[model samples]
Target: MMTPLGYSIMQALAGPVFPLDMANFFLWVTALYLGGIQAIALMVHSKWLKRTAETFLTLGTVFTFIFFYFYLNLRILSSHLYEAGELGYMGLIHALSMKNLVPAFIEFASPLQHIFFMFGALMFGLFQISDKIKQISLKTRLDSVYAVVAPPCPGEELRKAVGKGERRDVAILYADLWNFTPIAEKEGPTATMGLLNRYYALWDIVVRRNHGNIDQFVGDSVIAVFGLIGEKDACETAVACALDFLKEFPSLQADLADRRLPLVKHIGIGVHAGKVAIGELSAASGQPRVAVIGETVNTAARLDSLCREFKQELLISQTAYKPLSLEMQSHFQPMGEVLVRGKNQLQAVYGRK
Candidate 1:
């Protein structure tokens, strides 16, 4: 693409050996460098883009460098034809057929080519290093946030989570500590946060041990998911997880007492089976967070709220309850159909204390 400009450039440089055309080559180099710079400048702030921007810039730099090399070579080829009294399209064909072109490549690949190669490599390194740092930072943040035990996922599974409407039938588990507002108001922010963290840390162990993912953490509440992975029945896994949590309740309270903090207890849990889409999330300019979306998540949260009203420590939707093992079902009481928040129709839910 730069051939015509290179041809004009070659003409002026022939007399002075190093002249106006050399200066023009520098300008061409600047243009290629700036193209990469502008693209990175625009996309560097996004997490998704930051992950890919270096690759994109690297490709652009490589292609540009390739085109420039061919353009300069063709420019030199054009000059040979002019000297031989061959001109225009036919002249180009004749010049290309000639065997004398090999020596010209080494002649042109001097200080300018070396400089361009170094600068382009330098720019690529900068983009790649920046991208890697962001990746490490985001992974660290996710480690703290997701802090749940889940089966190892192939690289593609996480990629799927970033896509829109990537839905599947997964079990949702929503749990929240009882009377969080009162506790926070009584103990102040620091103590409340400490308590919340401790509670979640314990629950994190339960969910991870049960093969579930903590889809998200809302203030005083955690929304976990089962069947996003593993071959186990979603409902079965969810019930087992909840049962484990409830059975561990007394032990958790005892541990708190040992720490000499307020002896507190009780968290409500609601389980529902349905579809969930791992909603793709955007990064804040400084902070990045992922979001979970779909009606199933909402239904699970609503079920958790109703647990307090039903005076039960665990409440599960009819859909989830149906899939429970016969032995497990025997322990649950039928709470009947009740209106759930954000739904136009009443939903049948069961309870266990």
Candidate 2:
């Protein structure tokens, strides 16, 4: 049984072949439908068609001509009714009655032609929906990962507000993975990245446990600050986190050796208490990054770098060292004041035994 739509196509096709010929009318309608399909095909496959539009346009014209030819033949058959003696009359009338069957057949096939175009439109619509969903999913995943792995940096207006100058003390910790560059060069990029991830994870745990937020990561170094916008006991917190990081390092080192990778068994930490201009800086790439600048951060970094010279894994400046709790002071060894380079005044530095 034919559907109503299919039957309508048949009735439209089987109309008068001469006077009032709907077939010829249908040809022009079919051509218009084909035009729409071609336009849609160009849009759906724009990337591929951009290089080949002229060729596809030429090919599309050929297909239109082929369809027209089939329509012409249907007309001849409908007019002559398949009689052996009528072949000549069929060709003769087809050429002469162009105003009849040609137009009627085109009009009849118009709906079928448009129906074919709808398939192309449907496919293009599905592709658009799929691409939209994929983009949203990718963005969502990226946002979630960022929330877990990266610290948030304040926006421009917020940084500007912070930069207006407020006097406040901050406990700062500078942590450097032991011998990172040489291990990275020896292990290759993949293994090196894996090692860094494990190392950072340990830092994350220690810092978070001690109620400190990671301020920033610079290569293999992490800067964590306590006491500032939202913290108390900043000095004690920074020292506790550094000590905890050291205790976890040896076990982590053993695990790496088991995996046939170089162990980062030791790391250097430098802690200092001082005033800092903590705010955000816009990078060259137009992304904002949290930064601590001023003498406090400089002094801390200088002390961290000095660990290699002192043959020790951790150090605390006098400002932070003196304020430590009795329990915290018990674990540290006093290394007398040293004149750090690029500084006019002598700054106190200590080592962990």
Against the true structure, what is every candidate's RMSD? 20.6, 18.7
TM-scores vs. true structure, each candidate: 0.52, 0.52
- Off-target runs (Cα >4 Å) in candidate 2 are 1-148, 151-167, 230-232, 281-289, 341-343
Question: Model 1, range 167-222, lDDT digits (tens) per residue?
Answer: 67888899988887887788787766666665677678888789877766667788
What's the lDDT for all of these models? 0.68, 0.67
Clashes of 2: 16
Query: Least lDDT summed over 10 consecutive residues: which range in candidate 2?
Result: 139-148
Task: Report residue 130 deviation for candidate 1 (angstroms).
Answer: 57
Who wins the lDDT comparison? 1
